[model samples]
Target: MAADPGPTHPPQHPVLVVGGPTASGKSGLALALADRADGVVINADSMQVYADLRVITARPSPADEAAAPHALYGIVPASMRMSAARWRQRALAEIDAAHAAGRLPIVVGGTGLYLRSLMQGLSDIPDIPADVRQAAMDLQAAIGSPALHARLASIDPVTAARLHPTDSQRLIRAWEVMQATGRPISAWQADPPRDVPAHLSFTTLVVEPPRAVLYARCDRRFLAMLEQGAEQEVAALLGQKLDPALPAMKALGVPEIAALIEGRMDRATATATAQQLTRNYAKRQMTWFRNQMPAALRLDAMELASGTAFTKFYDRIMADMTKNITKMG
Candidate 1:
């Protein structure tokens, strides 16, 4: 048997990013690759960061974590709001640490914004003041998403055109930026990002499953989550009464499950509603990954779903790594 590389022989290009829609086997693929390559798995999904919703968010199980080193999963408290910037900073540190220890850094998740911030870099817009942010949030709450979107369009048409009318988060962000800095968010974005190191190299893989198969998996997964203590998880979170506007509170199954727990809806209705929402969210994720990561290698999720297909995929990656190491030598 070939000896495990351990911490001795680092690859020339040391990062791999696996991204896909929810329930598309991204975590499985990342773990398989990590096992083969002696890599460290880092979280890139926004929802998986919260310490509260591990089961509901489908974060890697304890067995998977023991199989390889995993970072950033379930590290933050549910009460704290984790922004993309904070995640990016922590991820960069994890990537650097992995490389220093001669392990491949495997970043995997479904969150497009998080991945984009890591890969393409992010705008260096100054932080919005608390008052500005609060005002934007208050206005949105009072007038609703459509009205807030209309207001954003009046001040920043470019940013407004890119966002959906119901996209409360981005709408509030744009409004806050405009209110804080007296410049549109789009204008600030046109300026170059402040800190992207030129030395980093990334190998990206995007898994897009067939829609019918993916949707079915989404539905089945939610049912499985319920069986696997998701209701209790939400019940605990709700017991804390964290701000409803917090991102953790808005995870895919969270609101529906909360409604069910609060007696506002029955189990059957809540399950169906959560399943539908998961499918819709998955559709949006699929579209975002397709459009934003154009240069990434695209594979069907089914290609990595089975042991045989995954073995083939793993072998290909290893072969490529060997060739690259040879070329470097």
Candidate 2:
């Protein structure tokens, strides 16, 4: 995705990235690929990176591990914020181990930033000055999104334009960037992009199902989670008083689930809210990949098993990798 032309030669080590929105069968597909190749599955999702979120985050289930080797799930603790740069280094090590053991590495999850970092080396954006970051965080903690946006509007309105009025974290980040660099964050991004080596040969799938059908699936999955102790999981995390700014606290179901816990909403209302948020997130995801990750092979989930889509899909990926390896030989 970077300006980098990428490797002229085929990657010596092969890897596969299986991605789609939540409840779109990404984990299932990763399991299938890993089973076929006797491979290791690595996590490429931001939420799944946290250890406290096994049930809530819908991380790889125990059955998934029994089906194939998996790395990087439930490793980071609840208190930390992980970035894509950290994940890429960890996944690269897992990829090396898989190859040495003659096992495949199937990277899976739906975080766009994670996949992009894997394919294009992350920009080494330096840390913002502590004073700047603290100022933004303090402002966010005090006056919230609108107030933060006012500050950003004065300095980096170009960057602020891309941020939704409710997108507090991003607005804070832009403000921090402005304070530290004295330049609009948008202007800084205009430089030619860096080329991080795309280390693995990969086949990516973008699962785009009919909106109605996918929405139904999201509702069903949320209800299924309710049956699976999702409420209890929310109660547990709420016990910790994690900062509202923390990513886990802001997962699709968290606020809704919290309301359920507080008796402000009934089970049905909370679950419905969660489902609506999930569907909206999926729509945003599809849009993002359409423009940002055009290389991903789009697959319609409506006719998943019985169509030329899946057949040609598998064949094209295999053939491309096979041709690359043969040429390498």
Candidate 3:
């Protein structure tokens, strides 16, 4: 018999992550996988980590969370800072443990960078000093976002071009780095970690619906949230006094949600604003994934409503992954 050609390089790591816009049924999908008790669910969403404002953030319900072997959600207090580096570290650790036990690590969330850091590595930046942090925050409070972006422009024009004037976190971080270390913020971002070739073989799926459909969905979903005690959740979140700059607070509908809660905007206004913001964000996500993940296994998924829909989705994904893994092996 003729000798069979063996595979050359081994495949990358094995991790299944489900990503989509808010209310896109990611959590339910993770939970369904866990129903078999053959998998562990870890959060990749940035907002779900904050413990204080769980309900408003649309975090996994306690029942769903209990139904699965969940990790990395509702652990961090809103007062503390959690970065992509930190989340990646935690996810890798959980992924390694789950794989060792022969369980699938069903990672799901909406945050793009958290997934990026897991697949690509993150820059190993040391923590900023408290004084430096306070100084930057104070400057932000004193001057304004425009002033902060101007300073970033002066320090690192390349970075400034990519950042918006109102991007509070990026603007403040750039200014903080420039002032504290006397170097451009962009300098520190030069050596972010690249591949996780040795850790696991994996497949990535990006859920991209058409712009009009996603916008309509976003509108319906936000209105539904209001009917389902979203106001109550917002009231709870208000008690946290979390920094407005926290990534959670910047979720698509969050500002408008907050506005409605605080009486600055009515429900109608909040609904309209949320729909617009979400639509814009969905388009941005689609663009990023389309351009950056052309090689990814793109799955054309509509609104994933029930836990079952997610199960079928991943069954398809894992089957494809297994085929590739076997070929590579």
TM-score of each: 0.89, 0.86, 0.82
> Measured by C-alpha RMSD in angstroms, how accurate is candidate 2?
4.9
* Number of clashes recorded per candidate: 0, 1, 7
lDDT of 2 by residue, 43-121 (tens): 8888888887787778878987877888999888777777666787888888888988998788888888788778766
The per-residue C-alpha lDDT of model 2 at residue 145 equals 89
Worst 10 residues of 3 by lDDT: 297-306
Model 2 TM-score, all chains together: 0.86
TM-score of 1: 0.89
Which residue segments of model 1 deviate by more than 4 Å?
1-13, 305-308, 318-329
Name the lDDT of candidate 1.
0.87
Error of 1 at 239 (Å): 1.4
Highest TM-score against the true fold, candidate: 1
Pairs with steric clashes in candidate 3: 12-200, 12-201, 13-200, 13-201, 13-202, 14-200, 14-201
**Which tens-of-lDDT digit does each residue in 215-240 have in candidate 1?**
99999999999999999999999999
In order of TM-score, best first, we have 1, 2, 3
Look at candidate 1 and tell me the lDDT of residue 190.
87
Give per-residue lDDT, candidate 1, residue 118. Answer: 87
- Estimate the lDDT of model 2: 0.76
What tens digits encode model 3's per-residue C-alpha lDDT throughout 90-133?
A: 88999988888888888887777787778776655566798998
Judging by lDDT, tell me the better candidate of 1 and 3.
Answer: 1
